[model samples]
Target: MSAPWLADAVVLAHLAFILFVMFGGLLVLRWPRLAWLHLPAAAWGVAVEWTGWICPLTPLENALRERAGQQAYGGDFVQHYIMPLIYPDGLTRHTQLVLGALVLLLNVTVYAALWRRRGGRRG
Candidate 1:
């Protein structure tokens, strides 16, 4: 594969992972039985960001890009793609923490709402 092709694949995979991290709970909400699967994935996603850990996917993408002679990015995939759109300046520790917290808070709120709905039906 060419360098550009590898870069594009990495970009797509990164985007998909982000979507899964951010909204996997929405899938769980739709299929309540999958809560077990989604919860862990959501937790892993939050933990990865909070700990400043590079997701396995990021490295895999970088490796593929390198094989194709593309220049791999230094930071996380989010910093390469999403940050520029959201922040004109750059990513900071505070912004990273806030993003991680927001992901946790959103999932928590979604689960709470689902629990309340389930409880209402029992009553």
Candidate 2:
């Protein structure tokens, strides 16, 4: 595939992963086994936001863009692509912290419910 197309694919995958990180707990509500995957992904997502660490996908996508001879943008994927859509004011440290907290809150709530549903079994 062309570099640009590959870049686009990476962007889509990044977005999907972000969505999964944020809401995958809901999926786990139905498929309990998914927590094995979702927990680590969610932790990594929250860590990225809290620590202001750029996700590896961001660099991969940027490299693909550069390879396509496109003018690669500065900043991480969430700042360049997502922040504009959600927070037009741009991403700040405070914003990142809030986002991290929100992700943790959502996942914790969902997982708690899952735990309850499973009768709080230890296995």
Best by TM-score: 2
Per-residue accuracy of model 2 over 1-123 as CA lDDT, tens digit each: 999999999999999999999999999999999999999999999999999999999889989999999988888999999999999999999999999999999999999999999999887
What TM-score, computed on C-alpha atoms, does each candidate reach? 0.86, 0.97
Tell me the deviation in Å of residue 4 in model 1: 5.3
Which runs of model 1 end up more than 4 angstroms from their true locations? 1-7, 120-123
lDDT score, candidate 1: 0.82
Model 2 gets an lDDT of: 0.95
Worst 10 residues of 2 by lDDT: 70-79
Query: Each candidate's root-mean-square deviation in Å?
Result: 2.4, 1.1
Q: Which stretches of candidate 2 lie over 4 Å from their true place?
A: none
- Computed on alpha carbons, the lDDT of every model, listed in order, comes to 0.82, 0.95
Model 1: what TM-score? 0.86
Q: Write the per-residue lDDT of candidate 1 for residues 1-123, one digit (tens) a residue.
A: 676677688778778868877997788778888788778878987887788888777777788788877777888877878889999687888888888999999999889888887885564
Q: After superposition, how far is residue 20 of candidate 1 from its true place, in Å?
A: 1.7
Error of 2 at 112 (Å): 0.3
